[model samples]
Target: MRPVPKQRRGVTPRARLRVLQLPVVLWLTLVWVALWGELSAANVVFGLVVSIVVCLVFPLPTLPMDLHIRPLRLVWLVLRFLGDVVVASVEVAWITLRFWREPRNAVIEVDLETSSDFVLTVVAEMVSLVPGSLVVEARRSTHTLFLHVLDARDTAGVDKMRSQVYALERRVVRALGTETQRLPEGGTP
Candidate 1:
């Protein structure tokens, strides 16, 4: 008779989607408010009733991942990400107009410093969502992404794209992760 092997204890494959919890909860609350309309006795009762029904009807599945969020830091990260999105949108719009005049594009590879797959996914999604740039390919093993950008002409152009990707990465890490390593006081170690 053979002895059974032990499985290591850690985040399971189905437990990584803690990120969606906040959005879903907020959505549910909004739905309840809409159903209830203005705050009144009848509406309040109805909202609670609907909220309870909604919670059971659509329970989020675990994704075997942990989102160790620092609340204040998460707030800052969200603000930073939104600000970047607005700025990126304007830049993308300008790039689009330029491409309309003279279309020249290039695919540049950006290396991701993050080790978390979840953070990488979110960062890639945000980059892809912005108009002027698209994430062409993301190789997890290499932690590099291929991005196709409109109107990229030189190394500086690619560097700009790289900077945007890293900025998004920094926000994601700050929001959803703990810094695993600290750098030296004055310079990179």
Candidate 2:
């Protein structure tokens, strides 16, 4: 007879590690080091202890996260995001230089395809990083963002802004979102 697999009790080692939020802990430690403006064994140890204490005191919020890191897609996303930043910077600069042509600013709403808070946060941050737009409000419950857009003068301009935001959201999903968050019309996110 085939032996039955033993049942595991309590949390596994991986689960315990997840609870520690290693990436966040490491980032906090790095920030502490930078704040001190020095690097030493003692500093590293102290930073780590402080990081752990802070993490324990105020734990990271638990989101419905199922991360599947695709290295290639992540690289592409970074490159594309950088390109967008440069282009937007130049455009915004041009707009500033031509002050005579008053740019029409508007608050446009964008409804993202995914309800994942992680995806929403990433999208909002990414959009805000690019020039010519900033997220004025984010409604997690509705999975929507209200962006203050520069030069959105008309309905067509508003539509353009909406599409641009949607495109950014799609890229974010393909970069880090789960398989279940695929775009509509059989488009792989």
Which candidate should be chosen as best, given lDDT against the real structure? 2
lDDT of 1 by residue, 41-107 (tens): 6765666556555654555453445678878867886776677678878977786666457757889
Evaluate residue 117 in candidate 1 and report its C-alpha lDDT on the 0 to 100 scale: 62
Report the Cα RMSD per candidate.
7.5, 8.4
Query: Candidate 2, 120: how far from true, in Å?
Result: 0.4
Clashing pairs in 2: none
Q: Which residue runs does candidate 2 get wrong by more than 4 Å?
A: 1-20, 34-39, 186-189
TM-score of 2: 0.80
lDDT of residue 8 for candidate 1: 32
Q: What's the TM-score of each model vs. the native?
A: 0.60, 0.80
Name the top TM-score candidate: 2
